[model samples]
Target: MSYCGHPGLMPIEQALNAILTEVQPVTKIIEVALIHCLGKVVAQDIVSFVDVPPADNSAMDGYCLAIADLEKTVDGVLPVSQRIPAGAVPEPLTSGTAARIFTGAEIPEGADVVVMQENCSEHDGKVLLPPVLALRDNIRDQGQDILKGSVVVSKGQRLRPQELGLLASVGVGSVPVYKPLKVALLSTGDELIEPGEPARPSTIFNSNRYTLRGLLQALHFEIVDLGVVADTFEATEKALIKASNADCIISSGGVSVGEEDHVKVAIEKLGRLNLWKLAIKPGKPFAFGDVKGTPFLALPGNPVAAFATFLLLCRPYLLTKQGVGNITTPTFTLPANFSRKKAGMRQEYLRANAEVVDGKMMVNTYPNQSSGVLSSTCWGNGLVVAPIGQTIEHGQEVIFMSYSDLLY
Candidate 1:
């Protein structure tokens, strides 16, 4: 009948899976300029129309010549028949002659090999190439990077700057991408005040607003920010209705079983909510539900708890809803320098920094693991995942996920 250290807590993985399973990917698509497509999901597979280079190009500033000619020459001396700068079309090579070529210059029609300028000697407009270099020594073959009709970008793949550049290189001017998700972001608590306001009473500036904003921005969401709502049922219900227009509504407080917490009561009147107590440290209370058909996720009030849960749980669900299939965060094992002699009932994600000790990465937790201590995350670079029912010792290898890895 009440919520305090919920007995039926969900395992971290199971909770994430359950949340992601019910969400459907948005199918809407929009065409954006090449430059603006960064951080967007590709709506369709993009097959390149032509080879990346479009032709055989030299990979060095050197001489291009037929390989057969070099084998026949006793003195290895060849006349420079043509000069081919980049963007210049070349005539067929004359017999016993080489074309002077710069890097990125198209190889002559008859040339089968390129000798870098350093390897060949030039005197009186003639180059003497040694026979030590192999055939086709420095030629970038046609279709080497991207062949015509090859898929350059696949459906549901997020476009990074390099991906956008690749699309541009393949002559794609505009890209079809999933429309940016409009997420209604809300923060609550009467003790919270937005930054830039002079504090009149006992209050803390709402850092979660900036925290969630940065997190969503990195994942390329268009946020509809609804600043801190009051701790009343009427206010909470009104805020939910206002946020219902967006595809998803996310709030950072008022889901716990406090007398003042109205998020659960408000959602019950409008829709259904599944308040999950996750078996994870720093973050435990997470609510997933819907209001007026839009998805809703209510996180804990603690800034660090909100951040951890968003990265480890909410982020995957949102990404899946956006059609991204690879929702798992990258993790690696590292030696832990700290120890926990007592086993924990739940998995603990310690805010710890890693350093190289004796050629091995060693992790050390921050001084404080308090959910409200934002400084712990500030000083640490990654999360050392100490599994449930397991005790860790010094020099033991543990699973770790860096903040840089999770955020991007």
Candidate 2:
């Protein structure tokens, strides 16, 4: 994956690699109950202390009998010596006799196989055995599912519902996980107004705040929202100082070269702007830097730009910082239902919908690809990555990234 665009602009892949290389995972680890471990990355490998199904057990509600005993029975009949239900221990199988065993019941010592109850009929004092039986049939061997001391879940793996169940299966009540990353969110623009406020001639409601907030929340990060800062160098500097207390800082707007864009200058005055600008459509003004010793990410003011840049760059960096091992968003190669006759210089991520048409999956891009059109994002389920200097034709194969893959 190489991208060709403006000489000074960084490629999206290079930008992501740089950000990941610079960020380090937090060292703090806390023990959390299994019920609360969802979306939390494990601090260490989770090893099983015991094997699942600690003992050989019956896999069916049937009769347990030693093969030799079954062979010795006359007229395929054996006396029932004992009954074993799930969780009940059984004595050694009486010779020439069978034990009535329920599913999950531990196999009695010296029992060689179990026959499903459907195969035999119960009488007044004996069970009629099947004419033939296979050794160990309908029996679950001990340790078949999981072995003792094996790693059930590796370090840095995020826990989902199934993971919680796995930990519980191994008798783990609590898990050690890295502390959630704390991020200070700042929206810088005087023209920005909070939602629910009266509309003004020149002010627009700040959608970036809610957009970034929702993204952060989806990743399970702690957010310190500083709200919208007045578009001034002083206000930006003050916010940066206050934001330094967090593990990382993410600010939207005030990153471009415009005179009112004071975040770039403020960051440089406090720390340093390591990287600026990216060769990506709708998000060329993205910036990466440090503010008062804390890592900072500056996004373009456009709501769509901020949303795309965060998923492409900031999300991975934040996940790395949170100790997650696999932060890559999955992409699929699908045929396009639309076409682009001309290619732009920068790589473009078009908001697109992917659906199955006549048994084939195809990508349908929204007609409008404007950075300021936030509605386009909601209208599409994923993104179609249009490479720099490349024109997409109808039915051409292209990389499609689903929002379901990126949101988390």
Candidate 3:
């Protein structure tokens, strides 16, 4: 399973899918308040017993009157029978009369249609309707948007603000949803310092922790941070032990085979490390395995490498393991604005800025494409994915993928 002449490695996608297929979502459900259920996966389909807009109502502030009432009007004036504002029930409509109903007000017992106030003039105790008006106009029907005993949301659907509002309209106070995936995060490097600490000449501040943490939160994960682990075997083993307790463990910096790196050996000693040297630039070193059945994803030490690996492999895998379907990174074809020299054996993702100009989509890579540079990612909105060993030319079609499309 070696890749690029490296032992103990496999293709990235194959390794990810293998682990994901073996793991299943924690098949437990909890009733959570609808207010806090946004971005959570629904455990089961939610069927509503009550229909939305239970009764026919006006969709706007207008007059609710029978079609026959408009026929007898000699001029534009018709006598107003009653005024029904929103949330109030009106008495049955008397013959030859109209009721003033506000938006969302239930239709009266005998009214069939609602006429907008703008269609004609409204004077003292009188409403005017055009002669060409049709029946049942401007009225919201019962069960129009959602029906009773129908599943409004399917299982494994992520709850959003609009979904919550829809469920509330059907009188659902709470919903059954899966718990957030608990991810253990840590950084392993003796030369790395915390953000607030002063860095020595050869030392750099730890960036992976914050980067991964932010991305994990965006994916609705509950993070358990193990902080920084020194490169020593003892400290690294202890950190791995802490990470093994979580549902999944993610560590950066020690997965590579550099002499100073020791995460791979520690992972093997503690549990397992299925190394995957993917044919992808900036994210070749990937590790996946389990410790006592808890999954572990060991990413590379380079900042861009870690980000790319997480987005391409870990993000979709985690989502699928948590009961999410349609787990794939979205990509689109856009014209390349710059030509670059590339000897392709591996797929390369160049940081690029995309814009639709003159009804055509275009992607232009930034000048700096360093693996360790954080500014390259910040300055670009998406990635230009060039296939394995494929050199791209200016104005040529290229596949572009956005970070937002991958995580959220």
Instruction: Write the number of the candidate with greater lDDT, choosing between 2 and 3.
Output: 2
Clashing pairs in 2: none
Identify the runs in model 1 with alpha carbons over 4 angstroms from their true place. 1-6
Tell me the deviation in Å of residue 324 in model 2: 1.7
lDDT values of the candidates? 0.89, 0.93, 0.83
Q: Write the per-residue lDDT of candidate 3 for residues 365-397, one digit (tens) a residue.
A: 989877888788989798988776567888999
Error of 2 at 104 (Å): 2.5
- For candidate 3, the 10 contiguous residues with the lowest summed lDDT are 1-10
Which is better, 2 or 3, measured by TM-score?
3
Ranking by lDDT: 2, 1, 3
> How does candidate 3 score on lDDT?
0.83
Worst 10 residues of 2 by lDDT: 1-10
Per-residue C-alpha lDDT of model 2 across residues 291-359, encoded as one tens digit per residue: 877999999999999999999999999999999998878999999999999988999999999999889
The C-alpha RMSD in Å for every predicted model, in order, reads 1.9, 2.2, 1.9
Residue 193's lDDT within candidate 2 is 92
lDDT per residue, candidate 1, 96-210, as tens digits? 8999999998888889999999889999999999876687889999999999999999998899889988998999999988998999999989999878889977999999999
Q: Report how far residue 387 has shifted in candidate 3, in Å.
A: 0.5
